[model samples]
Target: MKVVSRIINVVLVIVVLCSLVAAIGSAITKEPMLLTVIRSNSMHPVWERGDMVIIENLKEEKTIHKEDIIFFKTEEGSLSKQGWIAHRVMSGSREEGFITKGDANKYTDQSSDGTVPIKQEWVAGKAITIGETPIVIPKIGYLSLWAEKFQSNPLLIPVIALVLAGLIAFGEIKFTKKRKKKSQGMELQLIYIVGGLTIAVIMGGTMLTSGQNLGLAYQVSDKSQGVIMGSDVGILKVGDKVSRPLSELSNNGAFPLIGTINTSDKQIELSHERVILSKGEQIKSTYTVKAEIPGKYESSIRVGLFYPFLPASLIYFLSEQSYWLALVSVSLVPGLPLMVYPFVNGKMRRKTAKLLRRKKRKIQSSLPF
Candidate 1:
């Protein structure tokens, strides 16, 4: 019984440490190093909704080949809204671009105006697999999906932390009763655990509340003058331009953040490409859409939230290059300090204490009292 309990405790501690590492790594790299929940049945037999899969970022594995399952961003003019999709590579090459298809779909994503050939720059990451089989944790992702719905709530992280702390305290009470002499060590362990949890909560909360996709659906026709029916959807004629306010962007987290607005389409223009917000701040901005061609169009605006520790010039340059890179750089502001603290502070304190003890012993011996 005691051995089984020990094993369980070890497993729980390892899980907590790994969770902290993953949260910090994703923040610093701007690439997800944790499990992503499957949201659809497109992969069906391989893995379906509610299953979780791990991915390796494209930066780590630049060479993609046929039959590899990759996660990529959907093109602006594609049938589906601009978002991420995970599919298997069917054919094509780096120069020509690759063809992708869902495992259960009859046609390629490029077929019938679904999407253009998959560009190299569009790929985000590839699903991790072992010998043609993906590592899947079944049904566990439902918890994550459920948690996502409450991400906007400011109290969510605090509520969760409180619950976890209560559980830990209860366990400690039982353990201390059986081993009173080890109470001090257990208290130290509890402090470390709580501190790690706090960091993880802050990182997770910031990432979750930072960004969202805002889209505009409109039509261009030669017969009528341009008119915006609502904030997002509208009608326009060739050479016409219409502007409207986008949904308000809010910073619900406890810290200040930099929000950058970006678009893949040339016809769309934002009044403010970047805005900085303090805690609980909200801002509304407008975007103009130009009609160059006669057709229905959908434009997606990507808002990425980043920590504001980097220089404004550097942040602007990096944001222009890639939002992910800017995010990665900003994340290091907090992550690097946390990572270096233990090694620097703990070692220095230990060495200082040792020197002080040695000097005291020499002084006592010389006095011969």
Candidate 2:
């Protein structure tokens, strides 16, 4: 399993969960507190996407310390594109405010908004770790598509879920009971689940083929050079504008497309699966519409393993049920564990420290420093 993906999913679920907490918290308190989602990778490894946050507004004097995950409101970036960023406070104090930097970045972004000591009031709250968003829950965009298909016949989906759950649960229970009766007991049960999971992994892996699978017949988004198709990387034209499906486009190939860069096409100069059509080529005419490959319910799940959090989070956000309550509840659910995780982790750390100290003292008594 991809540890990063699991962490990201956990972040998304915690976000939904935290929103509920924030809602409740917001309702009960008479403060200017608010909650928002993590916008960037400023404070990563600790806080990933969909990580729910609690911003406790301290109006009078917002004090800060060395490493505080902060939500600093500022007029940074293009008004339209980069609205705000919530990064961790790298270093600073209440007097000099604080200098902040993203956990992942090499250097600090120390502007007034990026670096200055945030007034205690500007801060929201400390960040926390919740459980991961479930992988199964978010793929509902496809479900939503199917839901629309069965709109008039709505009961179709729920009935199916209930039925499937019931059947699987029943079979597993019966099989488990029978297995437990055997001499091998837990060993046999463990073996059965592991074997089943292994089969599933193989099946899922086989099913995933990737962009290369998009053949001549399958209509795919022709976001490439007008003349060439995918796997046919081309050069970038000065006047010909291009964009990629992904953020980072790797053009370290022989046929890098340098299409005419013009209006309507704006993206990273180099990114993959984006487009390389020249200025003249229309999005449609440039790329043949053989068979459009619809993006996954989530961002294309990382083919290999980085962490599927992005796609999973996307899937959760696009769940079939449009109810506000359901949406908020599910979003916060995964994050609830995150907030709890910090505390749990802190406790564990304290315990570990204490044990180390005791061991150290015993050693010192036996020997010397």
- Clashes counted in candidate 1 amount to 0
Q: Compared with the true structure, what per-residue lDDT tens digits does model 2 show for residues 3-64?
A: 99889878765543444344333333322235544445556666555444445454445456
Model 1: residue 263 alpha-carbon error in angstroms: 20
What shift in Å separates residue 151 of candidate 2 from its native position after superposition? 23
Return the TM-score for each candidate structure: 0.54, 0.27
lDDT by residue for model 1 (313-349), tens: 6877787887667765665444444334433567534
Query: Alpha-carbon error at 202 in model 1, in Å?
Result: 4.2
Q: Cα lDDT of all candidates, in order?
A: 0.68, 0.38
**By lDDT, who's the top model here?**
1
Best by TM-score: 1
